[model samples]
Target: MTVLDQRALNRATLARQMLLDRADLPVADAVAHLCGLQAQEPQEPYVGLWSRLRAFDPAVLSDLLVRRRLVRTHLMRRTVHLLAADDVLAWRTRHDAMLRQRVLGVYRGEFDGVDLDELAAAAREVLADGEPRTNAEIVSVLAARWPDPDRRALGEIVLALVPTVQAPPRGLWRTTAGVRTVALARWLGSDADPAGPDGDDPPGRALVRRYLAAFGPAASADLRAWCGLAGLPAAVAAVRDELVAFRDARGRTLLDLPGAPRPDPDTPAPIRFLPAFDNAVLGYHDRSRIIDDAHRNLSVAGARFVLVDGRVAATWTVDEGVVVVTPLRAFTRAERTAAAEEGAALASFLSEGENHRVRVAAG
Candidate 1:
């Protein structure tokens, strides 16, 4: 019945995403609250966390990886996400079908006539010994059984077939290492939670709730886009009674947890630096709330952006100890000052305080 204009949604997004003000939550709690950071770029989560959490320590995240409290896994749209180990275990089984389908979408011809269930079992066998293996290594072992299939295709299918974690030294802070994966169970010392016997509630119902918590007042399509799962309509239906819905200006129905934060439309938002693929911009079907439609591609293009007034206003990069900002729109003196302050802090964090130089490029 109520229409949430873009600015209203923008400020709400900023509040829910911890960008409106830096939060002092613990790193583990922050990871859980944000529903996990997009972590395909291993070092990027450190920056992502730095922008949100107050007094964030890079070692705390590294320790999470080493301690198995958090895991770098292929989940949620098949991207490598640094998720809470408990969340991954509870949600991984529900994502299996979507994961398999997505990989097939890209390599369907290559896997024709190959029984996927059989492929899954074989991939599990290869990974059962507890040794971490690269995608190439796993694919090579399976080549004997499916000799004609694309090796890359086979490798990707193996990841989809099994609950796997990209092992440490890869996602560890400031560490550059090749991806080596181990079974999620082995690495976390816990088994995937099995779907219940009743099957009354679907696998993704919890995901819908979690998504709303972090990226809520969103449409069903946005939920699907965020998780890459198509079967959640039933999950949403199962929980429809528990959610409240409103229509956006476009008449798209948005779902929200009744009590979640929806900050005032006029709330002042600070300039914050976001890491590449940060979900605050990508987790919506309609991203106009946080990024202009024209610049939407930047979120997926792996371009780190600067948020000014709760919207993307500049693109940033690092060169020779300098954080360079190229504005998409002319920034006012105050916005430029704010951007500089955040950029300098980001530079120090990126270079471990060895450099804090930031340059705002002429618009």
Candidate 2:
């Protein structure tokens, strides 16, 4: 088997993630292609999309949320993601067990002896009227039934048991609003597609295919880490024969769609600014392809990063119209120039062409 060195994998990741070159794809298609944006931070997706898509309009994403074309919901890894409405509906049922298990993992003692199926039914009843409710509001309705239960625990359980959308204007661009959830069905105006009775041909199988398409040449562990689902060994085995495999330098097997882009290792990579929790860094079990392990925690901790030569080289923040970059390693004069150029572009995008100032902090 061929061995893919870190640089080879890095360039491939950059290409697959659309960071090698900005893509001109539509926002909806880009969201679908990237699986979804990590959107717990509502305004971050616009920056994420701006880095990936050419001529991205923040309003297009905001409009999609308003028009019900895209939705914010707990799905993959039970975290808030902004997903295409159709993708969420089709994929939500597949993720039900994982969502429930994850919430339980965090609050198992609080929910002991509480019949979850009954809890689900009751929560659905509260949401059935089509009025969006805050998590606290929904939990208060069920407080009567579980008076002794922790209210926060009950609220989280209600979210896990019920497939819900964090409805707008929470996810609207530049809008700050508290989360108000409505049933996914009500929000989409259609019911979530029920899983097959036997749970055969499980949704994880499709998830595997999708993951490979977007973030592939990845290992099973990478898939598991990305989705937070534990039962995909069967899904991986079921599809193993269909994928092309390579061994990474670390000796883990990597799987990829046969025709997916695997760019040249020396392909010149431009500096790009990434939003907090952007999956390009978080989607892998082994993130050495795009980020150094020492800096890996920054990805999940919601620190926005700058990519230089297809790897994380600095952390960035904006203050007073200037984008500030603090480098993790010393940069060549050329890399600093490139970082400044991209940072200026990002500043312009963030301020709608008003501010393009950028400062590269001394290493």
Candidate 3:
């Protein structure tokens, strides 16, 4: 098998992630293409889409939320993600067990005697009216039935047990609002699709394909890392015939869709700004393809990064409308110029073309 070195994997990642060249796709399609944007931070998806899409209008994303075309929900890894409504409805059921287990992992002792099925039925009853409710609001009502578990734990398990979407304007572009959730089925006007019989897991198989399309040439471990589902080995096995294989430098088996873009290792990677918790860095078990080992913790620490030559080279933030870039390492004069130029573009995007100032801190 061909051994894909780090640079080879880096370029491939860049291509698959649409960071090598911005895509002209529409906002919802791009969201679907990327699976979804990690959207715990409400305004960050706008910046993420801005970096990937050409002429991305934040209003379109907000409009999608209002129109029920896009939704914010707990899906992969049980984190808040901005997902296409159709994808969420189709994939939400598949994640039900994992979501329950993850919340339990965090609050197991708190839920010792609580019957989760009963809790779910009750929670559904609470949400059945179709009115959006904040977590605290939902939990206060449920606190009467299950006063044993910590309120936080009780609320989290309720959300996991009952598939729910965080309602807008929680995720609306440039809008600051508290999280209010409604039942996923009620919000989308359809129940989440049930798993296929005999444990076929067609959605799991579809996820395997989709992950490779966007983040692939990856290992089974990487796929698991991306989706947080432990049972996809069966899914991978079912689809094994559909994929091509390669080996990473570490000798781990890598899989990819045959026709997916794997650009040349030396492809010129422009400086691109990424949002906190962006999956391009967090989607894999091994992130060395796009981030250095020394800086690996930054990916999970919610630091927005600047990609210099397709690798994380700096962390960025905005202060008083200025895009502030603090280099993680020394940059060449040209790299600095490119980063500033791109940072300016991002600032302008954030400010709606009012401010484009960028400060690249000394080396």
Candidate 4:
């Protein structure tokens, strides 16, 4: 019955996303809490972590990769994410169907008459030896059996069909490496949970909680957008008794954990730099809390952005050694100073303190 205005939701989003104030939480915990960072670009998570964590050490994230505590895998929405090994192992089974369907949507005609289960078993055979393989290598091995789908699609489909993870060095901090993958079980040393006790969904109820903790005060549509899972209405319904609900300005219902922090609408938010495909902007169907509708496409366009006053105000990229900010709109003097200040820090972090120059493109 309570109504939350856009500013109320905006402050709540910044609080939940750890952007209002940089958090002191551990890197691994931050990754898990944020439901994993969108990591297709690999090195982007370093900047993602740098913006959120206090005293973040890139080496620690690299250590996580080498230690098997973190993994780069195809999971939510079938995009590559840097997730905790435990999370990927626990949640992979739940996302298997979405991953398969998304890849099928792209390659359905080519894969016509192909038996998916048989293909999964065959792909597993290729990865069973514990050696990581590129998508090309895996597709080449399966070419004789299923040659119709091109090599790229064959590898992508197999990655979806079988639980697989891109191996280490691919996502290591400041390290550039090609993607190589092995079975998730081999990498994690265990199989994913088969299904939840409630039904065929594993951790859907828990996902609702986790998602709210990180990106809540959200609608059911937002949850579906975040995880790409359609079968979670039951999961939400099951947890309905435990959650508190509010209506957004648009009159859409928003559900959130009762104890989660919903900061005052006027809480001051800092200028922050976000990586490409950052979940904070991309995790919801209605993204007005952190981004305007007119600028919504930027989130999916892989544009790294600068958050001025907790809203997207500029797009940024590091060129050579300088941080370049191209404002989406004219910035106030104060906003310009904040943007340049944060941009310098990011450049220093990225360039190992050797470069901290920042350039602000007009308007």
Candidate 5:
């Protein structure tokens, strides 16, 4: 077995994530290639795409949302994601069980005596008219039938039980709006693909390939962490013949598509700004490839990061329209210059070319 050291993995991650060199792919193609962008914060995917796409236009993304070409939906670990509409429809059925289990895990006692199928049917009844509803409105309508669970939990559980998506304007670029959900079928004008017949999991197998294409040289554990589905070990086993394998420094086996780009370990990785909850850092169970273990918690802490030499080296935020970067460690003079240049570009993008002020705090 080949042993892939951290630097090799880091370069591979940067290439696969389109951070080594900004890609010229169209926004929809970029979104599909990356699988999806973590979009819990709504406007974050625009930033994530900006960092990866060479000539990204945020309005194109917003337009795609309004055109039903993209959707904001709960998938991949049951967190909100900005996904291609076709991808979401093809993938949602596979994630159904995990979504249900995760929500139930949080509100199990509240649903003790409730029949989940009945709950799903009732929720579907409420959505059958193709009306969009806020979580509160949905919960309020169901309150008379099932009032024990926390209203928030009931709202969450219903969304999981029924295939739903956050409607447009919620995820529109630079637009702020409350979440309003409509049935996935109604929203997309197409139904989610049903699961494969017994003894087969087609979507699971497809997810394995798609995940590796974007985040591979990864372990089974990493795949599970990325998708939050425990049933994929079989999916992995089924696809073993299609993959090549390597061992990480920790002696864990990493599987990847044979033709996927694994750039030279010393490739020069430019400074890139990543949005909060960006999967480039969060997609791996072991994120040492792109982040230090000491800073691992920052990946889940919702901190936007600055990648210096393909590794997380600073946290960033905007203040008064200025891009403010606080170094996590000392930077070389060149690193500082590069960070400033990129930060200025990010500021311009965020403010529609109005504000490009950037402040890199003292190391």
Candidate 6:
């Protein structure tokens, strides 16, 4: 088998993630193409889309949320994600068990004697009226029936049980609002039930394919890390015939769709800004393809980073409408100029043209 070195994998990742070159796709299609943007931070998706899409207007994303074309929900690792409405409805049911298990893993002792199925039914009854409710509001009502678990635990467990979409104004671009959730069915106007697993693997075989399209040439372990699903080995095995495999420098097997883009290792990757929790860095078990192992913790720390030469090179933030960048390492003069130019554009986007001045801390 061929061995893909780190630089080769880095270029491939850049190509697949739409960071090598900005794409002209619409906001909704880009969201679907990327599977979804990790959106616990409500304003993060706007930046995620901004970095990938050409001429991205924040209002377009907010309009999609208002039109029900996009939704924010708990899926894939049970974290808040901004996903396409159709994709969420189709994949939500497949993720039900994993979501439940994850929440239980956190509060198993509190739910010792509570019947989860009964609790789910009761929780559904509470949300059946179509009115969006905040977590605290829902938890207060659930407290009346299942007082064993504290309101906090009960609320989390209820969310795990009930498939829901965080209502709008929560994920609207540049809008700050508290999280309010309602049934996924109510938001999409259709229940989440995809067709049965086509092959011997399981219902998630389709997910395996989708993951490859957006983030692929990955190992089975990487797939597991990306989706937080433990049972995809069967899915991978079932789909192995259709995929081409390569060995990375680490000797771990990497699988990819036969026709997916695997750009030249020396491809010139422009500086790009990424939002916190962006999947391009977190989508694999081994992130050495895009980020250094020493800086791996930064991805989980919710640090917004600047990518220079397609690798994470600096941490950045906004202060008084100006973009502030602190480099993780020294940069060449040309690279510094490129980073500042891109940072200025991002600042203008974020501040609505009030600020485009970027202060790059001297190394």
Candidate 1 Cα outliers beyond 4 Å, as residue runs: 196-199
Q: Please report how far candidate 5 places residue 110 from its true position, in Å.
A: 0.5
lDDT of 1 by residue, 205-300 (tens): 788888998988899999988888777787898888999998899999999999999988998988899999999988988999889989988889
**lDDT (CA) for every model shown?**
0.89, 0.90, 0.93, 0.91, 0.92, 0.89
Q: Give candidate 2's whole-model lDDT.
A: 0.90
> CA lDDT of 18 in candidate 1?
93
After superposition, which runs of candidate 6 have C-alpha atoms over 4 Å from their true positions? Answer: 194-203
Would you estimate the TM-scores of all the predictions? Answer: 0.97, 0.97, 0.99, 0.98, 0.99, 0.97
List of clashing residue pairs for candidate 5: none
Q: Write the per-residue lDDT of candidate 5 for residues 1-363, one digit (tens) a residue.
A: 999999999999899999999999999999999999999999999999999998899999999989989889999989999999989988999889899999989887888889989999999988988888888888888989998888988998998899998997798877889999899998888889998853587888999999999998899999999989988877888899999999999999999999999999988999999999999999999999999989999889999999999999999999999999999999999999999999999999999999889999999
Worst 10 residues of 3 by lDDT: 195-204
Over 4 Å off, model 3 = none
**By lDDT, is 1 or 3 better?**
3
- Lowest lDDT block of 10, candidate 6: 194-203
lDDT by residue for model 4 (121-204), tens: 999999998899988888888999898887888888898989988998898878889999899888888998776755545388
Tally clashing residue pairs in candidate 4: 0
For model 4, the stretches where C-alpha displacement exceeds 4 angstroms are 197-202
lDDT of 6 by residue, 268-349 (tens): 9999999999999989999998899899999999999999999999989988888998899998999889989999999999
Candidate 3 per-residue C-alpha lDDT over 146-173 given as tens digits, one digit per residue, 9 for 90 to 100: 8889999988998899989998888887
lDDT of 6: 0.89
lDDT of 5: 0.92
User: Each candidate: RMSD to true structure?
Assistant: 1.3, 1.3, 0.8, 1.1, 0.9, 1.3
Ranking by lDDT: 3, 5, 4, 2, 1, 6
